[model samples]
Structure formats: C-alpha cells, structure tokens
Target: MEEVDVVIVGAGIVGLSVAEKLSHSFDNILLVEKEDSFGRHISSRNSEVIHSGIYYPKNTLKAKLCVKGNELLYNFLEKNNLPYKKCGKLIIAIQKNELPILDELYQNGISNGVKNLEIISSKKAKEIEPLFKSCGALFVPSTGIMDTHKVMKKLEFLSEQNGVLISYNTEISAIQKQDDEYILSFKSDDFQVKTKILINCAGLWSDKISEMVGINSEKNDYKLLFCKGEYYKTTKYKDIKHLVYPVPDPKGIFLGIHTRINLNGELSFGPNAYYVDKIDYQMDDSYHQEFYESVKNFLEIDFDDISQDDCGIRAKLQKEGEKFRDFVISNEKNKGFPNFINLIGIESPGLTCCLSIAEYVEKIIE
Candidate 1:
C-alpha cells in the first residue's frame, strides 16, 4: 500500500483549489478523480456565474466564503491571465407584486456585506439594459462570469507543478479508517493507499463517500438531492451584455430561469429547476414552451427563438420545499473519525467560493 500525507477525493474546481493551496505546505499530497478529466460534472456544468454573495443568508458559509472568494478569484484570475468578465447582474421584478422581493434581495445583499448593490427603477433598468422588461431590478455590480474550464485547468497545473500527484480515471471504491490513518481501496492495480488525512471533496458522491467511512449519511442529514437545471440558447436575442434574472422563488428556493451570456459573448437563457432521480445529462426539450413562457416575463423572445442548449445537476442538501441549507464542512473527529474532513452540499456559489473554501478547509486541518 502506498502512503501519503494527504489524499483528496474528486478533482473538480473545489478539489483542485484545495490541492493547489495545500500542496505548498504538505509533501506527498495526492488527488484522485473517477473521471478521465477534471470538471466533467457540476464544476463545468454550472452557469459559471461569479456570484456576489447576494442571495445567501448573512454570516453563512455561502455568504462569507462567496464574498471572500470573489476577491480571491479575481486576483487569481488576474495574476494567471485567466478570462473573466465583471459584467454585473440584475435580479428583476416584472410586476408590481414582485418589487418587494427585489427590495428584500437588496436588503439581504446588504446584510451579507455585498458591496455596490442598488435597487434600480424600471427606468434605470431600461437605461442599463434596454431589452429587459422589469418593474424594478436589483443591480449587483460585483457579479460576473468566467471561464470555469480555464480556472480548473490552471489550478490543476499549479498543483502538479507544486508536486501534488493527480490521478485521472481513478476511483476510490471504498475507504476504511484504521487507527490513525485511512486505508483507501481503488479500482485499478489492487491500488490502495494509506493517508494520515482524508479529505472528501467529492461533489455529487460526497455523501456516499461519507457512508463508506462509517458515517450514516441519512442519520447525519448529509444526503444529497439531485436537482437538475436545463438551459436554452437563442441567436435572435443577440448582444446581451450582462446577466438578467427574474425574481427568485418565493420560498427562497432557486433563482428563476434567467438570461446568461457565455464567455464567447453569446446570449442564452434557462436553468429551469426540477428534481431528478438519477445522474443523466440528456437535455429534455419537453419544456420548450414552458421555458418560453417563463423567460418572456423578463425578456422579449419569440416562441421559435430558442432551442435546448445544455443541462447541469446540482447535489443539493436542501430537499424540495425545504428552506435554504448551509454548506456542510467540518472535521469528523467528534463523529469518531479524526483527521477526516467532509464537504457536502457544495452547490452554487461553490465556484465563486472555491479558493476561500480551500482556505477554510486548510484551517480545519491546521
């Protein structure tokens, strides 16, 4: 069996960020991923939105880390010459009834310490985005978009250059805590490893990993609910300069389907949410009319203007109809697993919070 100082499971953006940050301090660090390449799942499939810490509750991990990560991400991107746009975002109210929700979000942003957030009138909203239809809008100036693939790749490179061994096409089938070290069973070559520290950064399968290590996922309330979102694109609505959003779900669930401009400067909309039972990436076009109906509340679009583009699944901790849940990150020593760290429910704002999440995890180990 191979021995290492630390072993991090999953090589998504969060895992890569953790590896990059920890490699400088620890030797013999190893990162393993089941996929043949990095960011093949949630990390790459997201809206790639650099969240502004607006929607999350104040002082929560999502809010604090997102705000801190926003600054860190910008600095990291600038230092590495990564491509990103500080394009700003709008959470709009299409009717008078929705104005209160916009104001509430503005207040939430303020409480969360999000800077430069303003509640703009429909006139000012039109002045900023002439095509958008809104009664009022919350302007988040710090919101932005970035090339997620580029960020993941750069983190991979930096970690490797710093002597962190990253193995692709590798999977940890099982793990056992043996006294002070964790013995990991892998898929290939009777491959096994013993690590003094085990960090579970597996995004979607994080709960299963926790189960393998003797933590009852259901009992611990660490179960992951798969909430899938679908997107659509349109060439007719060209030149969308910034993100445009509808008022969030009344239950504080999800931000409704909205418009997003990719890194290539193309206009697209979607990410209507629904719970799924399995992990499937098939794009369902059945909601074509529904998408049109929902999006027309905030933007002008013809029925024939859009087509199904892509979809992504979020490993949410909050079940349908449940209120917001914070990210689950902690050392499991009290749970009978010392030096074992688990990060569960790392969904949206995770990308924006990657570096800060890594820092938080590092502190846990220290």
Candidate 2:
C-alpha cells in the first residue's frame, strides 16, 4: 500500500490543475492516468477556445469560474510562454428574427460581467469579417484559442515540480472511504497501489467511479449523454482571423456550428452536436454535406474544400431538449466520503475554467 495525502485520478486539465494547486499545500500527492499520455480525452479533443464567459447564467459556478479562469489562464499563458492567441469571436444572427436573441445574449453577457462584449450591426460585422454575412452579431474580444496540449503539459510540469507524482498508464479500480481517509485501489502495467484521499476527476467515467465507492445515491441524476461533435477543416480559408459562431439555440445544449482558427493558423468549423451511444471518434463523411448546409447561412466559403478533421465527445449532463447544465462538483455532502470529491459533466468552458475548478476543489478539501 502506497498511502498518500491526496490521490487525483485522471490527468486531464482539471485533474492536473487540481494537482498543481494541491502540490503547493500537500506533499505525497499522486496523480494517476489511464492513458499512455496525459490529456488523451476531452482536454486534447476540444475546440481549444478560451471562452469569454458569455453564455452561462449569472453567479453560477460556470459563469463565475469561466470569467475568473479566463483572466487566470491568459495570465498563466503569458507567464509561462505558452502558445495562445486572443483571436476574438463573433456570434452572428443569420435570420432577422434571431437578432433579438443575440441582443439578449449581449445583455446577459454584460450582466455576467463579461467585459468588451458589443452588439455590432451587420455592416460593422461585415467590415470586421469580410466573409461573414449576418443580420447582426455580438463581438466577444476575450474568446481565443490555444494549444491545449501544451497547457496541459505545462500544468503537469508545474505540478511535478512541486512534488506531485504523476503515474501514467495507471487506472483506478475502486475507492473506499475509511475512518479518516479514502482507500483507493489502482492498477498499472507493473504494479498496484492504494492511497488515501481520492479526487475523482475521471472525465467520462466519473459516475462509474462514484458508484465504485458505493456513492450511487450521489450519482448524477441525469445520465451522461455522450454528444460527439465533429470538426471539418477548410482548405479554402486557412487564415481566418476570428472565431465565427452562430446564435446559440435558446435552449443552449449545443453552441451552433462555429469556426475556430488553431494555433497553426488553420481554420476549422464544426462540432455539430450529435448524440451517440459510445465514445466514438469516427467522422462520418455524410455529415460533411450537412455541415456545408448548416454553416453556409453564416459563412461565405467554398465547401468543396471542407474535409473531416477530428471529433470530440462532450459529457453533457443535460437530457435531450434541455438546456446546458453547470459543472457538478460533489464532495462529502452527497457522497458521504469526507475527503472524496467527484467532478462530473465538466464539458465546454471546462478547459477555460480548469484552474478555477481546481481552486474550488481545493477549498472543498481544506
């Protein structure tokens, strides 16, 4: 048995961020990952957008943490010499009727303390983005893109520098709460170990992990709906300057198809949300036609050059037709394990809000 003060499962951004903060306060911290490399899951597969905290409801954890994390992330990137760009974003209203919704989003953003969100006229929008055609748009200057893998590496490095032990290829088998601490069982290629305090940041398998610890009562009320979003790269427009997004559905389960330019200056649009049974990354070429039709209303580009790139799954906590749900951070209250914490359905803005989630989890442990 290799006892530790804290054991963090999953080496995704959130887990690594939590380890980074806790490493400074506690020694004997262990970070376990099932993958051969860190961030093989949601952390690496996202659109890499540093969100501006515009959509979430006011004062909720998502809104507050996203706003705060936006500031913290940019500062951290600058301090660490990471590759990132504040390319900005535009939420366009293609239909005249959708303009009201766009306006409401702008007001909501203002109320949420999202700085520099402006509602620009269609002419102004076209002036800003010559290829964009819309009735109206909301400009969010804080939205941007970054090398998420690099960010994760930096986080892991910092945590390791502070004495947090990272063990890749290690999978947690079970967790049990003892008198004063958690007893966690983990198996790796070579060995097995047990630890004390358990931090369940196991992205997709979070509910299963909680159940393993006999915390079924605290398991998410809504089943994890695996919504896989597929992206397509545009060979025609390779150097787009801004992220172009459509007015999100009022329900807000999925942000409409949008374009994001990566750190390499390659433009890609996608993630048309589709519910799936398994975590599959297979891109269906048939959807490419649908992508062309869906995005043509807002963007003026040659769809002939569009091709499948990659796909990422969102651990959506919301049921079908329901609005987007907030991140679930469960501690002793629901689970009965004093030191055990589980983070479930941490999807979009999750990459942006990773550090803030870490700080929140730290407060819970303390």
Using lDDT as the measure, the top candidate is: 1
Please list all clashing residue pairs in model 1, or write none if there are none. none
lDDT of 1 by residue, 1-366 (tens): 899999999999999999999998998999999999999999988799999998888889999999999999999999999999999998888899989988888899899888999998999999999998888889999999999999999999999999999999999999988997899998775878999899999999999999999999889999999989898999986767789998877765578888878888888786888888999999867999988999887777888999989898998999878889999999999998987999999998899999999999999983
For model 2, the run of ten residues with the poorest summed lDDT: 187-196
lDDT of every predicted structure (CA atoms): 0.91, 0.85
Q: What's the distance in Å from true for residue 72, model 2? A: 0.4
Question: What's the residue-level lDDT of 300 in candidate 2?
Answer: 70
What lDDT, from 0 to 1, does candidate 2 have?
0.85
Residue runs of model 2 more than 4 Å from their true location after superposition: 188-194, 217-222
Q: What is candidate 1's CA lDDT for residue 220?
A: 94
lDDT score of residue 264 within candidate 1: 85
lDDT of 1 at 240: 76
